[model samples]
Target: MNGLDEAVAASGSDVISASAGSLRERFEAAFMPNYGVPPLVPVRGEGCHVWDADGRRYLDLIAGIAVSSLGHGHPALVEAVSRQVATLAHTSNLFVNEPEVLLAERLLGLLKAPGRVFLANSGTEANECALKLAIKHGTATGRTYFVAAENGFHGRTLGALSLTGKPSIRDQFGPFPLDVRFVPYGDADALRQAVTEDCAAVFLEPTQGEAGVVPPPAGYFAAAREICDATGALLVLDEIQSAIGRTGHWFAHQHDGITPDVLTLAKGLGGGMPIGACVGFGESGTIFAKGDHGSTFGGNPVSSAAALAVLDTIERDGLLENVRTVGARLAAAVDAVDHPLLARVRGRGLWLAAVLTTDAAAAVQAEAQRAGFLVNAVQPDAVRIAPPLVITAEQADSFVAALPGILTEASA
Candidate 1:
């Protein structure tokens, strides 16, 4: 057997089989049980600390897969949601709510986009909105076809799924929407060849967040912009996992200095609350008219208020600067770990990961958890680190201090 497979098998034996039995049993009984047995049954969280059902506390580094930007149950979020619920919670799209309008304005002011916002409840829903907008643009301009990158992940909805290049997600979910093409990510020539005048849009992820936090090389995004402009295809960036200060910037794509025709956001926007949006830019802004696309609970007052609180706290608390400092220190620490088990470190800001020598990512994840820290094995050989933006230097130090021991345990 391969070295990675053998290590993975060895690591699996060390997992505490009934570590979270109470919550696991409850989950199996209550939920549809679709997820592959949850990692931990977290009961509460504060700052970067999470307590599981058995009262085990671990320093959180995953940040709910880059969703919980401010960390769990921040006072601002709690107050915002509480106040919003006590005031006005849910009003249909037929009516304009104050928080929704305010959130739209706030988000647009920060984003490089020009057009209006269509809010949704999740990243997938946000991508669905972008797809609808793309369809509207295509129909009006007599264009079809979409170009997406290999290893790209947009969302799970049929249309968004069609744009996603992962065969594991698409192979079973046919027959999908047609006219979608795939090309190697970060390859300007591949993108240029894939996009044509007939294509409606080209979807991309700034850093390919789920693809092991893979950042494109220099000029890749610029090249994409050039191709999209040359072919009359709108450029759409899926910032669902890389936006909302997760990467020490409003969006990871900002580092590339290129703006997209449309952008989808969700993961960290609401700071643990469910909210998403599809924002259009330039001529692509005015594509949506009335009744073209809408969502019921998309911009519900509570969620919008939660987003407002998150934005307020990020600005007032200066968490972005904190993320920059802590992320750099942590990245450097990982690089200096000097373990044969790790290949290298990748990503920018706080969205980083350690590529492994062997495909023992899951083993490493378990070992880290046992070592009183939490991380994610997003890819077989990569462990993604997307800690809360509020993570402090001390917390970053704690994680780094534990890495060698965790790596040793994982490798064993």
Candidate 2:
């Protein structure tokens, strides 16, 4: 069977909108208009394909901002979530739950690092948890100032926002929570100078997923680790957008062999079920200290089960290997393009981004959508490409073949 057919069979039966225009109009009228009108009101999706209200199909490349690891309706996710919700949707943090314990165990084992886990509802929650851990670590030592890399994004919450380095996101939200120092990313000397004993943690992103999918220079993560070590500060790596096979590794830091003391993960962890986790290693791993930190919906049975399913699928389907192969092809395909707007392509595994010379990310995204393809302007001159790990080589080729024309049209 073809990829689309296989995907639908695995997920719930196909679901398409009755009328995209009607749905869009209705959504415009009802929604709070916070996100400024979604590109389209997607009613149904299977694997890497989403059908609009008008029965038009488009190849998905963003993968719900790297949240849909197994794609829209994989059998594993559907079955796991269905079974989990039926059995137990949520049990407050007051009691110990089996699925939550099991999922934490699974994560600890996969991490191959000694640590404790704090679960939450989203990447931002995970970041908030990590920040809490760092704060506690600092409180115990009588220090709390933090160091975050420039262009780095942690979460939107006040605590996590204290560690975020994005100017625009933080501009209106401040004055921020507490002491946070922003240093130039990939600059080891800057980091060394910035991090002090008073610093609770050093927060960074292995690959800046929201910063136009920017990958740090070689040895940057290692240097950050060393700086954190020297300063006795916990290193927090925000892998929300890069973790769980998005970069063909359990965590993107694995590529650099540099594991952070605290790693914040979400996005694809529950395969779009809205789950977040903060895994701390050794001392950093055990700093929660009872009532100092907790979450009501974190580590709920159903979400934990769904995360387990996503992990199982990643292993069973050998999606990481697929990522290595197909991702290389996608990079080459995008690089082969001949266009003035096209500058370069960068990223790892299924999480690729096409860099353009002009700041026409929005126009290119629109053109791609019009051409029956899906992409996003994750940054001013970059369109992030993070398709589902289950995406076939043929699908990658299809996007590549259509990209040049899309670029040409957009540049025109």
lDDT of 2: 0.88
lDDT of each: 0.87, 0.88
lDDT of 2 by residue, 1-412 (tens): 7765566567764243246676677778988986777777565688899877666789999888999989888989999988988887888999888988999999999889899899899999999888888888898898869888888888788888877788888888899768899998888889999988888888899999888888889998898888888889999999999999988888899999977899999999988898999999998877876688878899888889999999999999899999889999899889889889999999998999999999999999999999998899999899999999999999999988898889889988
Residue 14 alpha-carbon offset, candidate 1, angstroms: 30
Among these predicted structures, which one has the highest TM-score?
A: 2
Poorly placed runs, candidate 2 (over 4 Å): 1-18
TM-score of each: 0.94, 0.95
Task: Report the C-alpha lDDT of model 1 over 4-58, residue by residue, as the tens digit.
Answer: 3365466764233235786577677888856867878776687788877567899
